[model samples]
Target: MAAGEVTLDPEIALFLREMRAEWAQHPPLESLGFPEQRAVCEAVRARWAEGGPRMARTIERVFDPGAGKLHVRVYLPDGAGDPAPALVYLHGGGFTLFSIDTHDRLMREYAAAGGFAVIGVDYPLSPEHKYPVALNRIEALMLWLRTHAAELGVDPARLAIGGDSAGANLSFATALRLRDRGEEGLVSAILSNYGYFSTTVSDEAEARFGGPGSIMDRAEAVSYYANYLTDIERERSDPLACPLLADLAALPPVLLVIPECDLLTEQSLVMDARLRAAGVAAEAIVYPGTTHSFLEAMSLAAVARQGIADGARFVAGCLSR
Candidate 1:
Protein backbone atom coordinates (compact mmCIF):
# COMPACT_ATOMS: atom_id res chain seq x y z
CA MET A 1 0.00 0.00 0.00
CA ALA A 2 1.17 3.54 -0.73
CA ALA A 3 2.19 5.62 2.28
CA GLY A 4 0.08 8.60 1.37
CA GLU A 5 -3.00 6.44 0.99
CA VAL A 6 -2.44 4.71 4.31
CA THR A 7 -4.91 5.93 6.89
CA LEU A 8 -4.28 6.28 10.63
CA ASP A 9 -6.63 4.62 13.12
CA PRO A 10 -9.20 7.17 14.18
CA GLU A 11 -8.35 6.90 17.89
CA ILE A 12 -4.60 7.13 17.24
CA ALA A 13 -5.19 10.23 15.13
CA LEU A 14 -7.11 11.78 17.99
CA PHE A 15 -4.26 10.95 20.38
CA LEU A 16 -1.83 12.65 18.03
CA ARG A 17 -4.04 15.68 17.73
CA GLU A 18 -4.10 15.98 21.51
CA MET A 19 -0.33 15.51 21.73
CA ARG A 20 0.23 18.15 19.07
CA ALA A 21 -2.01 20.50 20.96
CA GLU A 22 -0.06 19.94 24.17
CA TRP A 23 3.23 20.48 22.31
CA ALA A 24 1.98 23.64 20.73
CA GLN A 25 1.65 25.22 24.16
CA HIS A 26 5.42 25.08 24.52
CA PRO A 27 8.02 26.95 22.52
CA PRO A 28 9.43 25.39 19.35
CA LEU A 29 11.62 22.42 20.36
CA GLU A 30 14.51 23.51 18.16
CA SER A 31 14.75 26.78 20.05
CA LEU A 32 15.44 25.02 23.33
CA GLY A 33 18.48 23.09 24.51
CA PHE A 34 18.41 19.31 24.85
CA PRO A 35 17.60 19.48 28.56
CA GLU A 36 14.70 21.84 27.97
CA GLN A 37 13.41 19.77 25.11
CA ARG A 38 13.45 16.65 27.25
CA ALA A 39 11.67 18.46 30.05
CA VAL A 40 8.96 19.53 27.67
CA CYS A 41 8.61 16.04 26.25
CA GLU A 42 8.40 14.49 29.71
CA ALA A 43 5.67 16.90 30.70
CA VAL A 44 3.71 16.17 27.56
CA ARG A 45 4.03 12.40 27.97
CA ALA A 46 3.27 12.48 31.71
CA ARG A 47 -0.43 12.81 31.09
CA TRP A 48 -0.58 9.68 28.98
CA ALA A 49 1.31 7.60 31.53
CA GLU A 50 -1.37 8.17 34.10
CA GLY A 51 -4.63 6.17 34.74
CA GLY A 52 -3.32 2.73 33.81
CA PRO A 53 -3.07 -0.58 35.61
CA ARG A 54 -1.75 -0.33 39.15
CA MET A 55 0.96 -2.78 40.11
CA ALA A 56 0.81 -5.21 43.01
CA ARG A 57 4.28 -4.19 44.08
CA THR A 58 6.74 -1.65 42.76
CA ILE A 59 10.38 -1.35 43.83
CA GLU A 60 13.05 1.15 42.79
CA ARG A 61 16.72 0.38 42.90
CA VAL A 62 20.01 2.04 42.01
CA PHE A 63 22.85 -0.18 40.89
CA ASP A 64 26.40 0.90 40.16
CA PRO A 65 27.97 -2.20 38.69
CA GLY A 66 30.90 -0.14 37.31
CA ALA A 67 29.18 1.62 34.37
CA GLY A 68 27.65 4.61 36.13
CA LYS A 69 24.49 4.50 38.22
CA LEU A 70 21.59 2.64 36.66
CA HIS A 71 18.18 3.31 38.16
CA VAL A 72 15.60 0.55 37.64
CA ARG A 73 11.97 0.19 38.63
CA VAL A 74 10.45 -3.22 39.19
CA TYR A 75 6.70 -3.75 38.70
CA LEU A 76 5.10 -6.91 40.03
CA PRO A 77 1.50 -7.64 39.14
CA ASP A 78 -1.12 -9.27 41.35
CA GLY A 79 -1.09 -13.10 41.31
CA ALA A 80 2.50 -13.14 40.04
CA GLY A 81 4.21 -15.76 42.16
CA ASP A 82 7.60 -15.47 43.80
CA PRO A 83 10.50 -15.36 41.36
CA ALA A 84 8.09 -14.42 38.59
CA PRO A 85 9.32 -14.34 35.03
CA ALA A 86 10.33 -10.83 34.04
CA LEU A 87 10.53 -8.74 30.94
CA VAL A 88 13.21 -6.06 31.11
CA TYR A 89 11.71 -3.12 29.25
CA LEU A 90 13.47 -0.11 27.75
CA HIS A 91 11.73 3.18 26.87
CA GLY A 92 12.07 4.93 23.49
CA GLY A 93 13.00 8.54 22.81
CA GLY A 94 15.58 8.34 20.04
CA PHE A 95 18.07 7.45 22.82
CA THR A 96 18.20 11.15 23.67
CA LEU A 97 14.94 11.83 25.50
CA PHE A 98 12.31 10.17 27.71
CA SER A 99 12.73 7.97 30.80
CA ILE A 100 11.33 5.03 32.70
CA ASP A 101 8.86 7.41 34.29
CA THR A 102 7.67 8.44 30.86
CA HIS A 103 6.89 4.79 30.12
CA ASP A 104 5.63 3.78 33.59
CA ARG A 105 2.08 2.78 32.68
CA LEU A 106 3.18 0.85 29.63
CA MET A 107 5.39 -1.28 31.84
CA ARG A 108 2.59 -1.74 34.35
CA GLU A 109 0.24 -2.83 31.61
CA TYR A 110 2.70 -5.51 30.51
CA ALA A 111 3.22 -6.77 34.03
CA ALA A 112 -0.51 -7.02 34.55
CA ALA A 113 -1.29 -8.55 31.19
CA GLY A 114 1.53 -11.09 31.21
CA GLY A 115 1.26 -12.02 34.90
CA PHE A 116 4.99 -11.37 35.34
CA ALA A 117 7.36 -8.76 36.64
CA VAL A 118 8.53 -5.79 34.56
CA ILE A 119 11.87 -4.10 35.09
CA GLY A 120 12.04 -0.59 33.73
CA VAL A 121 15.55 0.73 33.16
CA ASP A 122 16.45 4.40 33.28
CA TYR A 123 19.61 4.14 31.22
CA PRO A 124 21.82 7.14 30.57
CA LEU A 125 20.88 9.22 27.56
CA SER A 126 23.00 10.18 24.53
CA PRO A 127 25.13 13.29 23.76
CA GLU A 128 26.20 13.62 27.38
CA HIS A 129 26.76 9.88 27.88
CA LYS A 130 27.43 8.85 24.22
CA TYR A 131 27.49 5.36 22.66
CA PRO A 132 28.68 2.28 24.56
CA VAL A 133 27.92 4.01 27.83
CA ALA A 134 24.19 3.25 27.74
CA LEU A 135 24.81 -0.09 26.03
CA ASN A 136 27.39 -1.12 28.61
CA ARG A 137 25.10 -0.25 31.49
CA ILE A 138 22.16 -2.14 29.98
CA GLU A 139 24.32 -5.20 29.37
CA ALA A 140 25.53 -4.95 32.90
CA LEU A 141 21.94 -4.81 34.12
CA MET A 142 21.17 -8.07 32.30
CA LEU A 143 24.22 -9.78 33.72
CA TRP A 144 23.36 -8.53 37.17
CA LEU A 145 19.86 -9.92 36.82
CA ARG A 146 21.31 -13.31 35.99
CA THR A 147 22.61 -13.80 39.55
CA HIS A 148 20.41 -11.34 41.43
CA ALA A 149 16.98 -12.12 40.03
CA ALA A 150 15.97 -13.27 43.49
CA GLU A 151 16.66 -9.80 44.78
CA LEU A 152 14.03 -8.40 42.43
CA GLY A 153 11.77 -11.49 42.69
CA VAL A 154 12.39 -12.20 39.00
CA ASP A 155 13.10 -15.56 37.38
CA PRO A 156 16.68 -15.55 36.23
CA ALA A 157 16.18 -18.43 33.80
CA ARG A 158 13.00 -17.19 32.17
CA LEU A 159 13.79 -13.62 31.29
CA ALA A 160 12.94 -11.59 28.20
CA ILE A 161 13.98 -8.16 26.96
CA GLY A 162 11.96 -5.68 24.94
CA GLY A 163 11.40 -1.99 24.14
CA ASP A 164 10.15 0.59 21.67
CA SER A 165 12.16 2.63 19.14
CA ALA A 166 15.61 3.29 20.67
CA GLY A 167 14.71 0.91 23.47
CA ALA A 168 14.06 -1.81 20.86
CA ASN A 169 17.49 -1.18 19.35
CA LEU A 170 19.11 -1.53 22.77
CA SER A 171 17.14 -4.69 23.56
CA PHE A 172 18.41 -6.34 20.36
CA ALA A 173 21.94 -5.01 20.79
CA THR A 174 22.08 -6.32 24.35
CA ALA A 175 21.04 -9.74 23.09
CA LEU A 176 23.80 -9.59 20.47
CA ARG A 177 26.30 -8.76 23.17
CA LEU A 178 25.05 -11.68 25.23
CA ARG A 179 25.23 -14.01 22.23
CA ASP A 180 28.81 -12.96 21.55
CA ARG A 181 29.59 -13.68 25.19
CA GLY A 182 28.02 -17.14 24.81
CA GLU A 183 25.18 -16.17 27.13
CA GLU A 184 22.43 -16.06 24.51
CA GLY A 185 20.27 -18.13 26.85
CA LEU A 186 19.92 -15.12 29.13
CA VAL A 187 17.15 -13.70 26.99
CA SER A 188 14.50 -16.23 25.99
CA ALA A 189 12.44 -13.82 23.88
CA ILE A 190 12.62 -10.37 22.32
CA LEU A 191 9.69 -7.94 22.05
CA SER A 192 10.45 -5.11 19.65
CA ASN A 193 7.87 -2.32 19.30
CA TYR A 194 8.33 -0.16 16.26
CA GLY A 195 12.08 -0.45 16.64
CA TYR A 196 14.40 2.18 15.17
CA PHE A 197 17.12 -0.12 13.89
CA SER A 198 18.81 1.85 11.12
CA THR A 199 20.51 5.19 10.82
CA THR A 200 19.25 5.77 7.29
CA VAL A 201 15.65 6.53 6.29
CA SER A 202 14.59 5.52 2.81
CA ASP A 203 13.72 8.18 0.23
CA GLU A 204 10.23 6.70 -0.13
CA ALA A 205 9.63 6.72 3.63
CA GLU A 206 11.01 10.26 3.79
CA ALA A 207 8.73 11.46 1.05
CA ARG A 208 5.69 9.74 2.54
CA PHE A 209 6.06 10.02 6.32
CA GLY A 210 8.86 12.55 6.72
CA GLY A 211 6.98 15.65 5.59
CA PRO A 212 5.60 18.38 7.85
CA GLY A 213 2.85 17.45 10.36
CA SER A 214 4.36 14.00 10.84
CA ILE A 215 5.16 12.76 14.34
CA MET A 216 8.75 12.03 13.24
CA ASP A 217 10.38 13.21 10.03
CA ARG A 218 13.56 12.13 8.30
CA ALA A 219 15.55 15.11 9.58
CA GLU A 220 14.49 14.40 13.16
CA ALA A 221 15.37 10.75 12.71
CA VAL A 222 18.82 11.69 11.32
CA SER A 223 19.44 14.05 14.19
CA TYR A 224 18.63 11.27 16.68
CA TYR A 225 21.23 8.97 15.11
CA ALA A 226 23.76 11.80 15.17
CA ASN A 227 23.05 12.33 18.84
CA TYR A 228 23.48 8.62 19.71
CA LEU A 229 26.72 7.93 17.83
CA THR A 230 30.13 9.51 18.20
CA ASP A 231 30.84 9.15 14.48
CA ILE A 232 27.82 8.63 12.27
CA GLU A 233 29.97 7.74 9.26
CA ARG A 234 31.69 4.89 11.08
CA GLU A 235 29.16 3.78 13.70
CA ARG A 236 26.14 3.92 11.43
CA SER A 237 27.29 0.62 9.92
CA ASP A 238 28.21 -0.98 13.26
CA PRO A 239 25.80 -3.83 13.77
CA LEU A 240 25.66 -3.05 17.47
CA ALA A 241 24.55 0.52 16.72
CA CYS A 242 22.23 -0.52 13.92
CA PRO A 243 20.90 -4.05 14.64
CA LEU A 244 19.50 -4.12 11.09
CA LEU A 245 23.12 -4.82 10.04
CA ALA A 246 23.77 -7.30 12.84
CA ASP A 247 24.03 -11.06 12.47
CA LEU A 248 20.63 -12.28 13.59
CA ALA A 249 21.51 -15.98 13.82
CA ALA A 250 21.09 -17.76 17.22
CA LEU A 251 18.97 -15.01 18.75
CA PRO A 252 15.87 -16.07 20.66
CA PRO A 253 12.34 -15.94 19.27
CA VAL A 254 11.53 -12.35 18.30
CA LEU A 255 8.14 -10.61 18.07
CA LEU A 256 8.28 -7.28 16.26
CA VAL A 257 5.31 -4.93 16.79
CA ILE A 258 5.43 -2.72 13.74
CA PRO A 259 3.38 0.39 13.18
CA GLU A 260 2.60 0.45 9.46
CA CYS A 261 2.66 4.21 9.03
CA ASP A 262 5.88 4.92 10.92
CA LEU A 263 8.88 6.27 9.03
CA LEU A 264 10.98 3.52 10.62
CA THR A 265 8.54 0.81 9.57
CA GLU A 266 10.80 -0.28 6.73
CA GLN A 267 13.64 -0.92 9.13
CA SER A 268 11.56 -3.42 11.12
CA LEU A 269 10.41 -5.09 7.89
CA VAL A 270 13.98 -5.49 6.67
CA MET A 271 15.09 -6.73 10.08
CA ASP A 272 12.29 -9.31 10.12
CA ALA A 273 13.37 -10.72 6.74
CA ARG A 274 17.02 -10.82 7.77
CA LEU A 275 16.13 -12.55 11.03
CA ARG A 276 14.12 -15.28 9.26
CA ALA A 277 16.84 -15.68 6.65
CA ALA A 278 19.34 -16.15 9.48
CA GLY A 279 17.32 -19.14 10.80
CA VAL A 280 15.87 -17.27 13.74
CA ALA A 281 12.22 -17.67 14.73
CA ALA A 282 10.98 -14.13 14.17
CA GLU A 283 7.45 -12.78 13.76
CA ALA A 284 6.42 -9.29 12.70
CA ILE A 285 2.90 -7.94 13.25
CA VAL A 286 2.27 -4.77 11.31
CA TYR A 287 -0.62 -2.85 12.86
CA PRO A 288 -2.53 -1.20 10.05
CA GLY A 289 -3.50 2.49 10.31
CA THR A 290 -0.96 3.19 13.05
CA THR A 291 1.96 5.61 13.43
CA HIS A 292 5.17 5.80 15.45
CA SER A 293 4.77 5.65 19.25
CA PHE A 294 1.14 4.69 18.78
CA LEU A 295 1.48 2.08 21.52
CA GLU A 296 1.71 4.90 24.02
CA ALA A 297 -1.91 5.66 23.23
CA MET A 298 -3.14 2.52 24.99
CA SER A 299 -5.38 4.61 27.20
CA LEU A 300 -7.29 5.83 24.17
CA ALA A 301 -6.56 3.54 21.21
CA ALA A 302 -7.76 -0.05 20.99
CA VAL A 303 -5.01 -0.79 18.46
CA ALA A 304 -2.49 0.26 21.11
CA ARG A 305 -4.04 -2.14 23.59
CA GLN A 306 -3.97 -4.87 20.97
CA GLY A 307 -0.29 -4.26 20.38
CA ILE A 308 0.43 -4.45 24.10
CA ALA A 309 -1.68 -7.59 24.45
CA ASP A 310 0.12 -9.19 21.51
CA GLY A 311 3.50 -8.45 23.09
CA ALA A 312 2.33 -9.72 26.47
CA ARG A 313 1.15 -12.99 24.94
CA PHE A 314 4.46 -13.44 23.13
CA VAL A 315 6.47 -12.84 26.29
CA ALA A 316 4.22 -15.05 28.41
CA GLY A 317 4.46 -17.95 25.99
CA CYS A 318 8.23 -17.67 25.78
CA LEU A 319 8.68 -17.47 29.54
CA SER A 320 6.34 -20.37 30.26
CA ARG A 321 8.68 -22.61 28.34
Candidate 2:
Protein backbone atom coordinates (compact mmCIF):
# COMPACT_ATOMS: atom_id res chain seq x y z
CA MET A 1 0.00 0.00 0.00
CA ALA A 2 1.07 3.54 -0.71
CA ALA A 3 2.16 5.71 2.19
CA GLY A 4 -0.59 8.03 3.50
CA GLU A 5 -3.11 6.14 1.39
CA VAL A 6 -4.31 3.83 4.14
CA THR A 7 -7.03 5.47 6.22
CA LEU A 8 -6.61 5.81 9.97
CA ASP A 9 -8.86 3.64 12.07
CA PRO A 10 -11.99 5.63 12.97
CA GLU A 11 -11.45 5.54 16.72
CA ILE A 12 -7.77 6.39 16.37
CA ALA A 13 -8.62 9.20 13.95
CA LEU A 14 -11.07 10.58 16.51
CA PHE A 15 -8.40 10.41 19.20
CA LEU A 16 -5.98 12.34 16.97
CA ARG A 17 -8.64 14.93 16.11
CA GLU A 18 -9.31 15.56 19.80
CA MET A 19 -5.57 15.71 20.50
CA ARG A 20 -5.03 18.26 17.76
CA ALA A 21 -7.87 20.34 19.12
CA GLU A 22 -6.34 20.21 22.58
CA TRP A 23 -2.95 21.16 21.22
CA ALA A 24 -4.41 24.00 19.18
CA GLN A 25 -5.33 25.72 22.44
CA HIS A 26 -1.68 25.97 23.44
CA PRO A 27 1.10 28.23 22.12
CA PRO A 28 3.36 26.71 19.50
CA LEU A 29 5.77 24.36 21.23
CA GLU A 30 8.74 25.87 19.42
CA SER A 31 7.85 29.32 20.70
CA LEU A 32 8.27 28.11 24.28
CA GLY A 33 11.36 26.95 26.10
CA PHE A 34 11.87 23.29 27.04
CA PRO A 35 10.26 23.64 30.46
CA GLU A 36 7.25 25.41 29.06
CA GLN A 37 6.98 22.95 26.22
CA ARG A 38 6.96 20.03 28.63
CA ALA A 39 4.39 21.73 30.80
CA VAL A 40 2.17 22.25 27.80
CA CYS A 41 2.62 18.63 26.72
CA GLU A 42 1.71 17.34 30.16
CA ALA A 43 -1.35 19.57 30.31
CA VAL A 44 -2.47 18.28 26.95
CA ARG A 45 -1.89 14.62 27.80
CA ALA A 46 -3.39 14.83 31.31
CA ARG A 47 -6.88 14.10 30.07
CA TRP A 48 -5.83 10.90 28.27
CA ALA A 49 -4.00 9.62 31.34
CA GLU A 50 -7.13 9.68 33.47
CA GLY A 51 -9.37 6.74 34.41
CA GLY A 52 -7.88 3.44 33.35
CA PRO A 53 -7.43 -0.01 34.93
CA ARG A 54 -6.73 0.37 38.63
CA MET A 55 -3.87 -1.59 40.15
CA ALA A 56 -4.01 -3.72 43.30
CA ARG A 57 -0.92 -2.03 44.63
CA THR A 58 1.30 0.84 43.46
CA ILE A 59 4.58 1.96 45.00
CA GLU A 60 6.77 4.95 44.15
CA ARG A 61 10.44 5.33 45.09
CA VAL A 62 13.44 7.54 44.47
CA PHE A 63 16.92 6.08 44.69
CA ASP A 64 20.43 6.62 43.41
CA PRO A 65 21.54 3.84 41.08
CA GLY A 66 25.17 5.02 40.88
CA ALA A 67 24.40 7.30 37.95
CA GLY A 68 22.04 9.70 39.67
CA LYS A 69 18.83 9.91 41.64
CA LEU A 70 16.08 8.14 39.71
CA HIS A 71 12.36 7.73 40.35
CA VAL A 72 10.45 4.54 39.61
CA ARG A 73 6.87 3.39 40.09
CA VAL A 74 5.82 -0.20 40.63
CA TYR A 75 2.33 -1.39 39.82
CA LEU A 76 1.07 -4.77 41.01
CA PRO A 77 -2.20 -5.95 39.63
CA ASP A 78 -4.74 -7.95 41.62
CA GLY A 79 -3.87 -11.67 41.73
CA ALA A 80 -0.21 -11.12 40.91
CA GLY A 81 1.86 -13.34 43.15
CA ASP A 82 5.10 -12.82 44.98
CA PRO A 83 8.19 -12.83 42.78
CA ALA A 84 5.96 -11.80 39.89
CA PRO A 85 7.35 -11.43 36.42
CA ALA A 86 7.89 -7.73 35.79
CA LEU A 87 8.19 -5.57 32.73
CA VAL A 88 10.45 -2.57 33.29
CA TYR A 89 8.83 0.04 31.10
CA LEU A 90 10.33 3.25 29.72
CA HIS A 91 8.19 6.14 28.48
CA GLY A 92 8.68 7.60 24.99
CA GLY A 93 9.15 11.30 24.21
CA GLY A 94 12.01 11.31 21.75
CA PHE A 95 14.16 11.34 24.88
CA THR A 96 13.10 14.90 25.65
CA LEU A 97 9.43 15.04 26.66
CA PHE A 98 6.92 12.91 28.64
CA SER A 99 7.35 11.09 31.95
CA ILE A 100 6.18 8.22 34.12
CA ASP A 101 3.31 10.35 35.39
CA THR A 102 2.19 11.12 31.85
CA HIS A 103 2.32 7.40 31.00
CA ASP A 104 0.88 6.26 34.36
CA ARG A 105 -2.35 4.81 33.06
CA LEU A 106 -0.60 3.06 30.20
CA MET A 107 1.66 1.32 32.69
CA ARG A 108 -1.33 0.41 34.83
CA GLU A 109 -3.11 -1.00 31.80
CA TYR A 110 -0.11 -3.24 31.04
CA ALA A 111 0.10 -4.49 34.61
CA ALA A 112 -3.62 -5.19 34.74
CA ALA A 113 -3.79 -6.80 31.33
CA GLY A 114 -0.73 -8.99 31.83
CA GLY A 115 -1.50 -10.00 35.40
CA PHE A 116 2.04 -9.05 36.38
CA ALA A 117 4.01 -6.20 37.79
CA VAL A 118 5.03 -3.13 35.77
CA ILE A 119 7.93 -0.88 36.69
CA GLY A 120 7.86 2.57 35.12
CA VAL A 121 11.10 4.53 35.12
CA ASP A 122 11.30 8.30 35.23
CA TYR A 123 14.54 8.50 33.25
CA PRO A 124 16.02 11.94 32.81
CA LEU A 125 15.18 13.80 29.61
CA SER A 126 17.58 15.25 27.00
CA PRO A 127 19.03 18.70 26.12
CA GLU A 128 19.80 18.74 29.83
CA HIS A 129 20.68 15.08 30.41
CA LYS A 130 21.90 14.05 26.91
CA TYR A 131 22.88 10.59 25.62
CA PRO A 132 24.12 7.88 28.05
CA VAL A 133 22.92 9.87 31.10
CA ALA A 134 19.46 8.29 31.01
CA LEU A 135 20.95 5.11 29.57
CA ASN A 136 23.48 4.88 32.40
CA ARG A 137 20.82 5.38 35.03
CA ILE A 138 18.45 2.87 33.40
CA GLU A 139 21.17 0.22 32.98
CA ALA A 140 22.19 0.67 36.60
CA LEU A 141 18.57 0.32 37.62
CA MET A 142 18.27 -2.97 35.76
CA LEU A 143 21.42 -4.29 37.36
CA TRP A 144 20.19 -3.12 40.75
CA LEU A 145 16.84 -4.76 40.11
CA ARG A 146 18.61 -8.08 39.50
CA THR A 147 19.68 -8.18 43.13
CA HIS A 148 16.73 -6.28 44.60
CA ALA A 149 13.91 -8.02 42.74
CA ALA A 150 12.80 -9.91 45.83
CA GLU A 151 12.39 -6.65 47.71
CA LEU A 152 10.05 -5.40 44.98
CA GLY A 153 8.31 -8.82 44.74
CA VAL A 154 9.57 -9.31 41.19
CA ASP A 155 11.26 -12.40 39.77
CA PRO A 156 14.75 -11.38 38.82
CA ALA A 157 14.98 -14.31 36.48
CA ARG A 158 11.81 -13.43 34.60
CA LEU A 159 12.30 -9.74 34.14
CA ALA A 160 11.76 -8.10 30.76
CA ILE A 161 12.44 -4.59 29.47
CA GLY A 162 10.27 -2.71 27.01
CA GLY A 163 9.17 0.76 25.87
CA ASP A 164 7.75 2.89 23.09
CA SER A 165 9.70 5.26 20.77
CA ALA A 166 12.80 6.42 22.61
CA GLY A 167 11.97 4.04 25.40
CA ALA A 168 12.11 1.19 22.93
CA ASN A 169 15.47 2.41 21.75
CA LEU A 170 16.71 2.41 25.34
CA SER A 171 15.27 -1.01 26.08
CA PHE A 172 17.01 -2.58 23.11
CA ALA A 173 20.24 -0.71 23.79
CA THR A 174 20.19 -1.78 27.41
CA ALA A 175 19.80 -5.38 26.30
CA LEU A 176 22.75 -4.92 23.98
CA ARG A 177 24.78 -3.48 26.84
CA LEU A 178 23.90 -6.43 29.01
CA ARG A 179 24.75 -8.82 26.24
CA ASP A 180 28.15 -7.24 25.87
CA ARG A 181 28.63 -7.76 29.60
CA GLY A 182 27.53 -11.43 29.25
CA GLU A 183 24.32 -10.74 31.23
CA GLU A 184 21.96 -11.03 28.28
CA GLY A 185 19.72 -13.47 30.12
CA LEU A 186 18.63 -10.69 32.44
CA VAL A 187 16.01 -9.61 29.94
CA SER A 188 13.79 -12.48 28.79
CA ALA A 189 11.78 -10.39 26.31
CA ILE A 190 11.54 -7.00 24.67
CA LEU A 191 8.32 -5.15 23.86
CA SER A 192 8.97 -2.50 21.22
CA ASN A 193 5.91 -0.34 20.60
CA TYR A 194 6.44 1.62 17.42
CA GLY A 195 10.09 2.01 18.32
CA TYR A 196 12.27 4.85 17.07
CA PHE A 197 15.32 2.78 16.20
CA SER A 198 17.29 5.19 14.07
CA THR A 199 17.82 8.85 13.24
CA THR A 200 17.08 8.31 9.56
CA VAL A 201 13.64 8.85 8.06
CA SER A 202 13.02 7.95 4.43
CA ASP A 203 11.78 10.42 1.84
CA GLU A 204 8.66 8.30 1.37
CA ALA A 205 7.93 8.37 5.09
CA GLU A 206 8.59 12.11 5.11
CA ALA A 207 6.26 12.69 2.23
CA ARG A 208 3.43 10.57 3.61
CA PHE A 209 3.61 11.07 7.37
CA GLY A 210 5.81 14.13 7.89
CA GLY A 211 3.44 16.68 6.37
CA PRO A 212 1.27 19.24 8.11
CA GLY A 213 -1.15 18.05 10.82
CA SER A 214 0.76 14.78 11.29
CA ILE A 215 1.37 13.69 14.88
CA MET A 216 5.11 13.87 14.21
CA ASP A 217 7.00 15.47 11.36
CA ARG A 218 10.58 15.40 10.04
CA ALA A 219 11.68 18.67 11.58
CA GLU A 220 10.25 17.77 14.98
CA ALA A 221 11.95 14.38 14.80
CA VAL A 222 15.23 15.95 13.79
CA SER A 223 14.91 18.41 16.67
CA TYR A 224 14.38 15.50 19.07
CA TYR A 225 17.50 13.71 17.86
CA ALA A 226 19.40 16.94 18.13
CA ASN A 227 18.16 17.35 21.68
CA TYR A 228 19.26 13.85 22.68
CA LEU A 229 22.69 13.76 21.09
CA THR A 230 25.74 15.94 21.50
CA ASP A 231 26.90 15.19 17.95
CA ILE A 232 24.32 13.90 15.50
CA GLU A 233 26.70 12.94 12.69
CA ARG A 234 28.93 10.93 14.99
CA GLU A 235 26.27 9.37 17.20
CA ARG A 236 23.71 8.67 14.53
CA SER A 237 25.46 5.42 13.61
CA ASP A 238 26.38 4.35 17.14
CA PRO A 239 24.76 0.97 17.68
CA LEU A 240 23.81 1.98 21.21
CA ALA A 241 22.13 5.12 19.96
CA CYS A 242 20.65 3.31 16.98
CA PRO A 243 19.97 -0.35 17.79
CA LEU A 244 19.02 -0.97 14.19
CA LEU A 245 22.77 -0.88 13.59
CA ALA A 246 23.54 -3.37 16.36
CA ASP A 247 24.18 -7.08 16.11
CA LEU A 248 20.87 -8.76 16.96
CA ALA A 249 22.01 -12.38 17.40
CA ALA A 250 21.36 -14.16 20.73
CA LEU A 251 19.17 -11.42 22.15
CA PRO A 252 15.88 -12.19 23.87
CA PRO A 253 12.65 -12.55 21.96
CA VAL A 254 11.21 -9.24 20.68
CA LEU A 255 7.64 -8.23 19.92
CA LEU A 256 7.42 -5.11 17.81
CA VAL A 257 4.11 -3.24 17.85
CA ILE A 258 4.16 -1.28 14.60
CA PRO A 259 1.72 1.40 13.58
CA GLU A 260 1.35 1.39 9.82
CA CYS A 261 1.16 5.14 9.29
CA ASP A 262 4.05 6.18 11.50
CA LEU A 263 7.21 7.72 10.04
CA LEU A 264 9.29 5.29 12.09
CA THR A 265 7.37 2.30 10.84
CA GLU A 266 10.06 1.51 8.32
CA GLN A 267 12.68 1.33 11.03
CA SER A 268 10.72 -1.32 12.89
CA LEU A 269 10.17 -3.21 9.65
CA VAL A 270 13.89 -3.16 8.85
CA MET A 271 14.79 -4.13 12.40
CA ASP A 272 12.38 -7.06 12.26
CA ALA A 273 14.08 -8.39 9.17
CA ARG A 274 17.56 -7.83 10.58
CA LEU A 275 16.67 -9.60 13.82
CA ARG A 276 15.34 -12.64 12.04
CA ALA A 277 18.41 -12.73 9.79
CA ALA A 278 20.56 -12.76 12.90
CA GLY A 279 18.60 -15.74 14.30
CA VAL A 280 16.83 -13.77 17.00
CA ALA A 281 13.16 -14.55 17.47
CA ALA A 282 11.30 -11.39 16.50
CA GLU A 283 7.63 -10.77 15.86
CA ALA A 284 6.27 -7.63 14.27
CA ILE A 285 2.54 -6.93 14.30
CA VAL A 286 1.62 -4.05 12.03
CA TYR A 287 -1.53 -2.29 13.11
CA PRO A 288 -3.31 -1.00 10.05
CA GLY A 289 -4.65 2.56 9.95
CA THR A 290 -2.62 3.52 13.02
CA THR A 291 -0.11 6.28 13.70
CA HIS A 292 2.72 6.92 16.12
CA SER A 293 1.72 6.95 19.80
CA PHE A 294 -1.55 5.29 18.96
CA LEU A 295 -1.12 3.00 21.95
CA GLU A 296 -1.74 6.01 24.22
CA ALA A 297 -5.30 6.17 22.93
CA MET A 298 -6.24 2.92 24.69
CA SER A 299 -8.88 4.77 26.68
CA LEU A 300 -10.88 5.30 23.48
CA ALA A 301 -9.32 3.04 20.83
CA ALA A 302 -9.80 -0.72 20.65
CA VAL A 303 -6.72 -1.10 18.45
CA ALA A 304 -4.63 0.39 21.24
CA ARG A 305 -6.14 -2.01 23.73
CA GLN A 306 -5.45 -4.92 21.42
CA GLY A 307 -1.85 -3.83 20.99
CA ILE A 308 -1.43 -3.63 24.77
CA ALA A 309 -3.04 -7.03 25.23
CA ASP A 310 -0.85 -8.54 22.55
CA GLY A 311 2.24 -7.16 24.22
CA ALA A 312 1.05 -8.39 27.60
CA ARG A 313 0.57 -11.86 26.19
CA PHE A 314 4.00 -11.80 24.57
CA VAL A 315 5.69 -10.73 27.78
CA ALA A 316 3.78 -13.22 29.88
CA GLY A 317 4.61 -16.04 27.50
CA CYS A 318 8.29 -15.17 27.39
CA LEU A 319 8.63 -14.91 31.15
CA SER A 320 6.76 -18.15 31.70
CA ARG A 321 9.24 -19.97 29.49
lDDT of 2 by residue, 1-321 (tens): 233777899989999999999999999999999999999999999998999998888888999977898999999999878879999999999999999988999999999988889999999999999998999999999999889888888889999999999999999999999999999989999999999989999999999888888889888988898999999999999999989999988999999999999999999999999999999999999998899999999989999999999999999899889
Query: Model 1: per-residue lDDT, tens digit, 1-321?
Result: 234569888999999999999999999988999999999999999999998898889999998856679999999999888989999999999999999989999999999999989999999998898898999999998998899889999989999999999999999999999999999999999999999999889999988787888999999998998999999999999999999999899999999999989899999999999999999999999999899999999999999999999999999999999
Clashing pairs in 2: none
Candidate 1 lowest-lDDT run of ten = 1-10
Evaluated at residue 56, the lDDT of candidate 2 is 81
lDDT of 1: 0.94
TM-score of each: 0.98, 0.98
Supply the global lDDT for candidate 2: 0.93
Backbone Cα, N, C clashes tallied per candidate: 0, 0
Q: Choose the strongest candidate by lDDT.
A: 1
